[model samples]
Target: MTDPTGVTITERHEQDGIVMEILEWSRLGGMTDPAGLPLLALMRTAELPVRQLRLTLTDAAVVLEAGALQAWHGRIEVENTIPAGRLLRRMVGSALSGERLFRPRYSGTGVVLTEPLLQCLLPVGLQDETVIVDQGLFLACSGGIEVGAAVQRTGSALLFGGEGLVQTRLSGTGFAVLQSPVPDSELIKVTLKKGETMAVDGPFAVLRSGSVRFSVGKSAKTWFGTAVSGEGLMQILEGPGDVWLSPLQPVYDGFAALARTLGPDATEAAESGRRR
Candidate 1:
């Protein structure tokens, strides 16, 4: 299906009473450089597409991150139901966890569209359980789910785990939409039986079942061993549940940092030459 602005639905995901469509634009407008058009077209062809979320709600409500709603149509009522007594607590939690300060709820039968995003959107279903997610990953969720904050189990973990002191926690039964650093295909889900454990050198494990216990530990038994192995502290999770890891997250992070550092200066030089 195509939106009124000519964006087309490129993909659809439906499960457990949730229906979401990914809308894509064929080409971007308002480019500063005509010469970059070929490169942008090639990127689109390579599936680095500009995308948005189109959610269809039928007699249900969804909680969304503040300022996420781009457009909506039909019988929808939007509200922020956070209690006055808990407002300060919620604000402090949001400040520490990197989550939005206010989450608005939209109810009734209608279509809700979200702002376009370059990151991948991952829809996760929970069945009367809880999941601990990395900071800033939450996008939206069914209203039945409870969204809160969780802290590291230990001080060392809080200091060295690289996942921040507080993370987003989603509990109860419903679907959650998360902004992922990598596509679903690149995500690795590891299910562990009781007493099992997993460890990684970075904060690549984005989501884990609430039953899983998280901590930080040395990669080797001793300092000498760690130096020889060239690995230091590692993020450790012991579980009777699941953990989702994005192994390629570091690569993407590195390139993003490079772009941020170089993009503005390069653009300024080009514009200066044009003026000359």
Candidate 2:
């Protein structure tokens, strides 16, 4: 799966008239300093793959997240297909669901590429089914799919579930690409039977099928019981469908926060305080 441009196709997915290739760079360039060489070697040893998506389309159309298009080739036409009548409604839905108001649609035959991202790209297929995903997870989808907003079923879920009042809902028969915080290997998929329940303490549930119901409830019968159990409110999902959970997302978030705190600006401030 190696390409002439030093990019390797780590994964490939083909479904519903689209071919997607997950490209990863074997080695990064542009570093000239000897000191940076050690850091680069360390990054290679750590296996931190920088990935991107390459899509091949033939007489088909796809909708991409705003600003996701990096480049394209062949005969392709791009347009914002927002109808004037639904402009106001789309705007409000975008605000509540945290999705961009305008998603560019690319139609015709072409090879499309998206900007390189550190996050993992997950491709999901649907056959007359629907799935609800957390906001900001959507990257691209086939034109046959319908993208809309889904509101929280209850007030407690909206307030305590950690996901906002609305989430992104995708329906119809096609494929969708989602930007996941963690790699697919780390994701835990749970299929629940009818009336089965799953509870989580954090916003670790990234996605759930449309048949599932999301809510929030106390971990124990009372506040005192919850405190004693060391668990408080939990996000609850009642289902007869699939749910994808990323239990390691919180660890990644903690590391990112620590990196920000120890960034160059903080280092410079510390040096100034020491000098003073």
Candidate 3:
């Protein structure tokens, strides 16, 4: 049968249990390693977009891209497969979850957020706090996150020096690590899907909801302006890799350089434009 996105779904028998809903892509993240292919390949075979990917078991001799999966895509050996029960037995003894796979799926909210615009949580099972956010970062929470005047407070479990802690506020909350984008620095692109609009400082802004209006001004407190339009859409942001949140030193250095280069020119141009 076809799923919500018109992709077909079906079930098939494999080495163990059943491979349900393989996707149509014939590949996992462009990987061709026979020994380390994701089982999602089965879902791809069935023609789905892998809205969500997760590992049911780790250390079960399931290999994905030849990694240990201490993090994301990791695997064991196909030639020497271990039973799921054995895998779980090890985890139960070690007091850890054996499932260590990543699942990437479309957001039911029709939105997708990149690392710069999204926040990650640690002690994740215990804390539901928002740990970090860039000044004009985009967030594609299936259920929209708090923002604008309505945003009162947010929390996060920040990582520093290989440890985690609670951060109640964004500023002065200590260093929060952020994943850097691919390209270092230059121009970034933020694409707005249909019915989506955004309102933020132009240089740093990514995708905005289509329902919002974009304007330019210099009101320190209310620096940007906005208005509702329709069902808001997702924002796609692309820019320098350094846009990520790093330790205060690098962040401050970047900000300082920007201000130094722009401060005088900005003031002069503003004055020139006014006189014209």
Candidate 4:
């Protein structure tokens, strides 16, 4: 939908290397509620080309993944939350892997902006809850919560498979926001009862935490058995918790499918490089 101005504020534009959309509406008109509360909500501006996700905060705090603030207005307080001597080790692990250990805490009475890639925001509700997130995926969460330590797995297959070594975990009683690759409509939430087990052949898992046991192991006991199983390395999740997965498979799936679509020329070139 167009902006309320009848002019062109909601339109998307590319400046320098960044793509941006200027939003305008009644909410953006400095309108406040009866108690003087800001109308905070996530607004979807356009469906394609430039899909937008807007979040407004009313007198709250958000822990942003460091350096993610795009723009903001009104009463905003920004501060760097440095870890003390007790938590230095855990914080250092995240910093080594391209993620900021000590992220900036955003709290105030105004609105904050984010995004250069136009990704959708996934708000995760936490009640002493914990979410193990891929590095750099941490967006913003309520001030009541805390960003916990990093998670690591030393499996040889997991590293070479591109899952990486470090992931951030947020835990507390509030809502944590994450930058979602798939939109909320496309995210599939699967609830597994206690003692139940499920395995995914791909890294489709977005978030898996809370009483769930997660590991990367062989698809089968034997090499020949794995071949018959038609699965190589697998992400195993044992529950009593929720798992969010994407239908698009994983990151590699996109490249593989695109290569197939571009036909034999692309496939042959990739195969030739692999041989070399």
Those runs of model 1 whose alpha carbons end farther than 4 Å from true positions after fitting are: 1-10, 13-18, 29-42, 260-276
Instruction: Kindly list the per-residue Cα lDDT of model 2 for residues 199-245, writing each as its tens digit.
Output: 89999899999999898988998988887897789998998999999
Worst 10 residues of 2 by lDDT: 266-275
Q: For model 1, give the RMSD to the true fold.
A: 4.5
Candidate 2, position 144, lDDT:
89
Question: What is candidate 2's CA lDDT for residue 261?
Answer: 82
Candidate lDDT (C-alpha), each: 0.83, 0.85, 0.27, 0.63
Segments in model 3 whose C-alpha atoms lie over 4 Å from true places: 1-127, 130-132, 144-245, 248-276
Sort every candidate by TM-score, greatest first: 2, 1, 4, 3
Give the alpha carbon lDDT tens digit for every residue of 1-276 in model 1: 345675777667775445778777756766889778655654555557677888888888888888888999989999987889988998887777676777899888888989988888888888999999998888888878988888786989878889887888999988888999999999999998899989899989999999999998888998788778878888888989999999999998896687578876645554555457
Per-residue error for 190 in candidate 4, Å, reads: 1.3
lDDT of 1 at 177: 88
Expressed as tens digits, the lDDT of each residue in 1-276 for candidate 3 is 123444223222222221212222223465577543433343354343422212222222122211211222323222323357565553453243222222122211111112211122111000223323332221112111221111212121121111112111122211222222211233244445544533332223322222323333222323232224331222222221112222233454575588588966644554455457
Best by lDDT: 2
1 versus 3: better TM-score goes to? 1
State which candidate has the highest TM-score. 2
Ranking by lDDT: 2, 1, 4, 3
Question: What ranges in model 4 sit over 4 Å off?
Answer: 1-58, 154-162, 227-230, 250-276
